[model samples]
Target: MSTENTGSLDTSLVAAAAGALAVMCASASFAGVLADAGWLIPALITVLAVVGVGVLGRRLGWPTVGVVAAQLAGLLVILTVLFASSSAILGVLPGPAAIAELARLLGGTGELIRTGVPPVPADPPLQALVCLGLGVVALLVDLIAVGIGTPAVTGLVLLCVFAIPASLADRMLPWWSFALGGAGYALLLAAAGHHRRWRRYEEPDRVAYALFGRTTAVVAGTAGVIAVLAGSVFTGVGTEGRLPGSVPEEFGGTDGIGLQPFTSLRGQLNRDRVVELFRVRGLQQDSYLRAMTLRKFDPRTGWQLDGLTQGVDANAPLPLPEGTTIGRGRPERIEVQPIGYRDPWLPVFGTPVSVSGMGRNWRYDPAAGIVFTQTNQETRPYTQQVIVPDPSPEELRAARGPMPIDPAYVDASGISPQVAELAQRLTADAPTEFDKAVAVNRFFTDPANGFRYDLTTAPSTGQDALSDFLFRGKRGFCEQYASSMAVLLRSLGIPSRVAIGFTAGYQDGTEQVITTEDAHAWVEAYFPGWGWQTFDPTPLSDGRTALPQFLDTALHPPQTPAPQPGQPRPGPVPGAPAPPVAGAQPDSRDVPQQRREPADRGWSITVLALIVLLACAGAATPLAIREIRRGQRLQAITEGREGAASTAWREVLDEVRDRGHQPRDTDTARQLADRLVTDHDLDATGADALKHLVTAVEREWYAPTAPSDGTLTDTLEAITRSLHHNAPLDLRSRLFPRSALPPWRTTP
Candidate 1:
């Protein structure tokens, strides 16, 4: 083969790897999205399918369009069923109804994309949309960059994917995402543009090839830096890119989750780390600062807001509280400063009157009574002038109006009947609605009602979550207490919404440092004249996190990992802390509860070691079988009594099978010679060699006596070459010989 032809063989492999890297680059954006882990499997399948089909297409002589079309069809069928089918009604794959359901889930995407806040506790609709979106992107990158042989075009497609997510989110994208995307595009350009040295020409194009390589690297490197920098800068991977991409060690970086807020699903209310998110000054009393209020409740999906949101400019006069007599009411000028946490919303005391010395990204909604920023909003220090009202018990009782609260609060369409009944039983004594609300809040959080605060509890979703929290072992942190209180109050005709924000931090002189541990939620009951008042039904203190007296025998999320009477549960725990069972928790310091002993250490280790040895032996089995067969042929030569005949004949049969032909095991020495000579167009020398071997074996077996053989090694070697020359160079025939494998295991 020509030198150029040898290089072309290498080019194809490099191109295939480049194509996979391109898909990975685009899929890297998924890391910031909520369902990132779920997207990885589908993304991998897409890349592998593209490369696999491309290889097969080359062998089958298919065009580029055909290969692209085949890969697209396969990926669509796979991803649609994997992601969309399970979520569909009745679990049918590729139905119109399922497609419609997927569309319905994706309907509010524009708003979600615009908000750019990652909705944790994964929205099923959003998961489906992301799965399909990335699949299509992978196909486009594969076809345009790899199939069309212009890898430079892939940079544009990747840029669009990176820019949209980065513009919306302030969180930094991981550095590797940019690096991989760049490397893939550069490799593709090199493979397609200059690596095809196999095509022979009158003159070599060394200068042109060298120039193209240099150009591709410079362009690819530039694109990579831009894409990665955009995400990292937003993520507090800061502009300098010096901050480590991973969670720091002090913050339980063991599992990759750094300190985040209560905004995430089942918040990691850090049990240890003290990394301050921000600092606040002014309010001496415990300040409940609101970030994003989750008001709109859906039965199928839990807390989400789909209401009308109107935006006002940053410095614009925020609309005063409706029907408010509570103006500048306990006015507190709060000075806030950010440490490392980057948030779009500047945590401020709500019913925020005004903000100064901030960027233009901030916007306010009169309806929600909250101020948020969009553009330069990641943790900018701002001094907010807020009106904090503390209406007394007497004033709150008398506070009444036309009920300007949204009708959704009073609808109570999906509140659990158990919760409603419980509310009725709890509030039967209270004469007024305001008093009844207070009674309900106290009843739920009262330690006498068997509730305690534990950050490790698993939260439930949907309409009946209140029922689970109340009836199924009432032991959760602040979210359960707050959410249940709001639902129960709503059931009793009280207007309420769940407020998400941080609790008062540990004070340092005038300044208060708020850590991730302080993130909390509380219920706000809307009163006509007094406005929305925050209530804490959560018994944060004075109660051990252990479950109630009544629920000792009951099974809850926290207790799921403990071994039952007839069961032995193994493996590290799921998303809950160590269960208070089987000595998992210490029973006093001295002579603590003994852990259950595991089975048979010596026997298990021995068995495992044997299994590993057997597996290694199995891998080398082909080489072993080849050597054994060769030794048997050697025994037939020099040492054996009869035969130049048996040695020569066995060599010919072994060569034919090794070179990609499977002949009958029963064929005699002479019969094998007849077939090999005719089927393979062997020369006269090869035919003569085969004839002499067959005659010798026949004479040794059937004649009166065995003949001492003349040199038959040359004859056997000639026949072997003829067989090897005609055999196809497919992977299986050369490396994986039929002789190395058993007769029944051979493929046609």
Candidate 2:
């Protein structure tokens, strides 16, 4: 190729690269808006690919490897920019420590990958990788086709072949999808062949291509603008589908449990399952399936489970059964770990001694170890004491009595006879109600007995789910286990109910934040005399115990072993503090005391206002200094008899106004200068000098040329003297009469 052709090719490649870079940057910056505009990042990349091909064709360049590398680099740049900006892409990736500072400011570290803020909503990281891969492939095809002198029409056709699959891959696939999509796109592009359109050369006057390009640009710009406007409106409005408005009473209130109006039926069923699981365990203790408690149940809507009522007299006593032992022994420290949705209901093992730091509406249900809150809010983890009656083994073994079923519990007479028969058969060979309960608990808890834990939603076979679980699919989660237990126990004349809470799992260093994933269902049954008891028959065989796995790894990280077995352990480094063992409690003496200063309204306000004023002044200092430096530079240039002499003169006119000289809006620069000189008592020489400065400034401003340094120096000196002599006693004070001044400023 000729040198001219090579130069053209190089320019075209540069232009293409620049265009691709611009598009990538734009997409990254406004990803959310682009999503709203239906202009996905993948689509933007395809457009960039098209632009690249066009540039390649015009410049007559053909370097596939270079194009692919350029595209990849562009993608990396886009990711970096988006990550820096705290856009969705940043949330998707797990960044290195170097980006931690940036991540902190952007609030990007916690967000889920591929999703925007509220990290849980984003697509997985694997999906993002796929989209990036597709982008690279698309660019490669563009480079190859364009370099071969493929006609613009032919290339345009080939571009679409690659674009569609890339879009789908980005939308559907995780990391692997990108490769698959890229392969498909490449195949399509290759199939389009090297057909070149002769029409452009045959009809050089054709305006179709130009019109198409302009139309595309206009459409893209318009869509972008609309997307921005729509996003602004949505953000202003805020999220529409939020959770329940009120808190649950179990958080800290005397109110009964109430459900949110729109509580999903699926959630209710899940909760019911948990209650059944407890029943199957046959513990016969009043266990709380703590959820949101409602005090002020709206008669119309039923119950608005708000948060715990503020300021309930928690010191008051909870009603307990007569003859019930109070403080019979030291309270058992039950550490509850709620693993699922951060609901407001606080869970405990038994009757609580006292709930500390609970909301006002919340109250401890001493009879049943549970904390009640008035409202249902997000879930959180807490520790509370439970007065668990640990009866002796002899007492438990000798216990024999009728199961104290709740009066409200319906008997099997209400159900089909077969159900009752099935329950009898399940409880056969048990001598007492307690034995039967034990039998039920063992059957469900025994994983070898066909019980299986699954996360998939089980299909509803019929109303008698217990029968189905016992005979059909043994695979089910906590809900199925609990439900089956409850139904069978109730059938056998034992009063039972379901309890829903989270299983203790991951210890979040200090305490685990109960995620929604840990939702569990169990059974609670009432034993005569002993009161209500808790039982959980859900098989614990699964890796649910993996919570300690994280803890173990964190606490016992692998370290280099000492060469000699009897050698003393290494001591602390010269300055650094010794590292604490995993789960070791900090020394009480080392704990820092937080001292709070007494509130002083007047002093606080005054201090705050003064600080704010100082901050403003500090921020403005740089701008003030910049202005002063510019003025000095102008003065010096004028004095040197260089360019900008006239500009320096005009600046002097502005200085006159700054010294409290009121000039008419339409006043000429000369008029303003003359007024300043006359009103400020400037000498005739100074006054004339001011007028000459104005003329020079106006001339330089309108036409522009090198300013004479001498002229600039003269104008600066004249303006400085005039302004200092006529300095305002507070510029605003001179501008307005005392009576017209604001009252506050007048006093100061």
Candidate 3:
């Protein structure tokens, strides 16, 4: 092969590596969008495997179309091995089951992308999506840079990879990622230009190649340094203060700084990590901190906040609920400090009698039991003298007829008929509104009723959503439970609303620290004389949730049925107990068990090994077959079989073609010999061997004796040795020999 061809080969290899590196650098921008770095290793492996396949195909002299096909096949196998191994054959080859599994993963990832927030958990589906997406990107990079021989076009693919995280996150790309990607692109451009320079100079001088290489390195290094400095100035990755890209370890509602309970609640509860939102000092009892309340229910939108309610100045004493008087019950004073929380509505422990140390913009909505401001909650602490009234079951049952609250609170419009009927049936025997509320709560929290807390369901509201939750699914987190129970209460003509806030968080030292994981939603039923009272129907799997004192059976025992004369007293009704359920207030020292299904660890490792093994084997199969074929031809010549001289000449042609030199179809034996000697600059031994081979080829065709020589193998070896000496074969040429493939499979 000529020096120019060699330089082109070298450039292709360099471009392949550069493309892979560039892809990885771009993928690093996802750090700002994923909750964790778990997706990185899988994505990197996928890109490398795809690029490796393309490089191998090009080396083997396969056509661009063939290389692309091989890359796509390899990508599929890799994904199968990594994500759908259990569904594949021997965990290496993709089967029908594997395809189905892949489709399922794709669907799951698409759903998460649509419904989840940025920094969503890096689950298996998301990781699979990242791997699949980056694998295609790597294939594109290789096809453009190596197959089409254009490295510059790969910038578009790299940009697309970086754009995903940039669009999802409200911040600039990480500086290091930008710098590394810039460096990769610079190296690609420099390497791509190297071959053109060699072609222009028309020289095979070692000094020229060395000089060009050194110059390219210097240019790439200088560009990389400039990129680093520029990125640092613009992105602010490691700055002390918060920047646009530096998202805090906090959770917000659906809309920025405002609680949109239905979707916001799901996002917070499903967060990958817990973040402290507030710290409370002097909390007297377990209470649900109120931020806002949703009273408007629409079939299409589910539960929404009562947007028309106005508030009075929070600095002055707040009025109590209508027709309610301050009892002699002792009031608790508390101070709440916003830690990492960002929301317009302030968190208050209970119905506030007086609030102090807040800005003038902060207002108190007595109807909603919410303290609010038009702006975000200040980090500064605020004091509240709040009252949580303890009403007896009899008092609560008697205070029910109708409250003076807005009629909309009890409006049951748009509720599904199935949900309404189900609620009526569950509470048919109950005599009072409080009993009906308790019956509804038991229907959800009761394990016997099959209501399990699950976060996998997508957030939705309306009559259909309620029907799904209450009748068919029977599984959901706090949002579903709260919305369903509130609507069910309204169906029974009781004034109720869904309250959004934090649960009574676990005590840390002297402070009650409320975390984003503690964010919750529950029902509040209004009694005629008393204010809105709390009722939690959600069966939380986590043990941090505390039951209200009114629901504690130890304080107020529920009535049990009498036993018959002949039979023993029946055991306590399953799922009917108010408190002391499996998920209610476990010992604080106990570790909470995660509700997510555990991954199949042993199966995963086995499949991963299979995938890597299969990918390596696929790359090596062509080279292995080529070697076997070469051995058979050389054996025929050694045995002096029929047409041994022709076999020797044919082998010589393949060897030359394998090394990037293609002989013309019209060239005669003598002409081919002359061209090989002059082009390769073969030594005396190779020249003599080539002369003999050309004479033998002519003799084999023209001479009637059918020429055969015992030394044919030796002569062919000499010519091959000379060819190697003139332009030594490298590992790449040996592995991806173009002559091993059919003419149609190669560029010729």
Q: Tens digit of lDDT per residue, candidate 2, span 357-438? A: 4444555443333455444332334445546555432343355565433353323334446656756765666656655666
Of models 1 and 3, which has the larger lDDT?
3
Q: Clashing residue pairs in candidate 1, if any?
A: 4-198, 171-235, 172-231, 172-235, 173-231
Alpha-carbon deviation at 722 in model 3, angstroms = 79
Model 3 Cα shift for residue 172 (angstroms) = 19
TM-score versus the correct structure, for each prediction = 0.44, 0.36, 0.44
Compose the digit string of candidate 1's lDDT tens values, residues 63-135.
Answer: 9888777777666555556656766546645577666655676786644442234423245555556556665
lDDT per model vs. reference: 0.57, 0.41, 0.68
Better of 2 and 3 by lDDT: 3
lDDT per residue (tens digit) for residues 487-573 in model 3: 889999888988888898889999998977787888888888777888888877666566666665422366766877998877644
Residue pairs in collision within model 3? 60-736
Candidate rank order under TM-score: 1, 3, 2
Candidate whose lDDT is highest: 3
